[model samples]
Target chain A: MNAFTRFASLFGAGKDASGRGGSSPECRRVGEVLQMYLDGEFDGDTSWLTDHLDECADCGLDSAEFQQLKDAISRLGQPDTDTRQRLQEFADHLAGGEMDVVDDPV
Target chain B: MEAAQTERDAAFRSYVVPELDVMFRVAMSLTRNKADAEDLVQDALVRAYRAIDRFDGRYPRAWLLTILRNAQINRTRRRRPELLHDPDTEMERLSSTKSGDEFDPEAVVIDPVFDASVRQALDALPKKFRRPVELVDLGGLSYQEAADDMGVPVGTVMSRLHRARKRMRDHLEQTGFGTREID
Candidate 1:
């Protein structure tokens, strides 16, 4: 499916004649929390979600697609070396009492 | 007094020093400017050092992030009142070469075209949607940490972030990336 239709299925917007546009209860549940799972923030037992993805092709594809997107975004930014060093030095100064914390505006 | 000072410094070093990188990342997301982010982190560090004696030494990341967020809020209130509403202007103030300057060298292993596409997709998001992504995806904050930083509920952060990623994913697919089926 194309992006629009695929994501539309995610929101229960459109479904094919087979009623398989992620309309199943398991798929629906996965759809609701798949991002949470991918984000490592899902709170409860995730075994069912994993089992559903393992057994179902469409859910598996969705999981992989979101995972790919998350991975891509996560790799886009980093702390530059100069900033890291500067922050380190600042921390060192504060730890060493070289900076006056009481007079500084936090 | 000297012994107490030495103990406080040791505690500050042990608790706050190791989290400098994380503080910088979260600060960058909050300020969206390299200089402002550095300043904010320093301010947060100062606050953290002052409070290190009272800190219970658990979840130091969360404690430091809370301090950083509070510092950003106070800084905004005291200095840049305009930044409270104008995300576009804030985004513009972000260094043009920020991505290039900060792109992790290890990420060079990934496809350049794909990375560029992802950046474009991210830039296209609305500021509300974009902030959560930057905090969680880019800054490595957990959902709750991002929620705390953004002053929103965890569910709200999750919803915005999930929708944002979906939009980015759609954009990537339209740009002829990540559309193929997995093996």
Candidate 2:
């Protein structure tokens, strides 16, 4: 596996050998686990929440709320509209396109 | 040396120039000023260009960022001793107040109050925490991708991110901006 997949799997987000995961202590939430969830870093194991949501409603609610907080946090102080436009333009330039320069030797 | 120079020039056109803006944004997050950011980005690009032959090309952006990060460290080392001490103090002044406001404090507010709050919080984070947030949130790198770039275990990256977000959330709460309680 490449570095990306290697690292991701190490973080408990990679696919398991079984089609579905069996109950493992690894499923428990720690600070790091909550963090990955908040960042939407999951690999979409439907079984991811099945364990916690089944036993603990509080953790499940926290997970859902944390998702909202993550979304809102991302929106805070987002680059202004003009700056976003400029950033997009810059990204496009990197992706291979020329932007119109108002003043240039040409 | 000859091979390095040739490789550098080619990388400059193929990689560095194309990714200038992305590089600048990352540098801006590090140096927090336009002039310094420009210098940092240029320095990194030049170095990356020179080292292109050694580059594996598996992840050009990560490689460049590693070089840029090293360049930033070297530049920091060369700065006058007094300036390096409490560098955050200077950055704070730059961030809290406007760019230039001689008579009126409101005339040239450096950043909007809300934006300033956010910037201040981000700047306050430790490098371990800050780097993950900057790499993923601002630099648009994924968590796994950042782990590889930062050369850390993925669990470490997640911990840093969690701590960083908690710090940011606390700062926002203290400033009465964000209402989410971090526990």
Q: Best candidate, TM-score-wise? A: 1
TM-score, model 1 to reference: 0.70
Clashing pairs in 1: none
DockQ of every predicted complex: 0.39, 0.06
Task: Estimate, for each residue in B32-123, the C-alpha lDDT of model 2 and write its tens digit.
Answer: 55456667765675566446667766777777788888999999888986654354564455445444322123322322344445656776
Q: Which ten residues in a row have the lowest lDDT in candidate 2 chain A?
A: A97-106
- For B53-131, candidate 1 gives per-residue lDDT tens digits of 8899998998998899899888877875655535455334331334544545555544444655677788889999999
**Lowest-sum lDDT 10-residue window in model 2 chain B:** B101-110
Model 1 agreement with the true structure over A26-91: per-residue lDDT tens digits: 889889888888888788999998888777666766776677667766655456677788888888
Tell how far residue B88 is off in model 1, in angstroms.
11
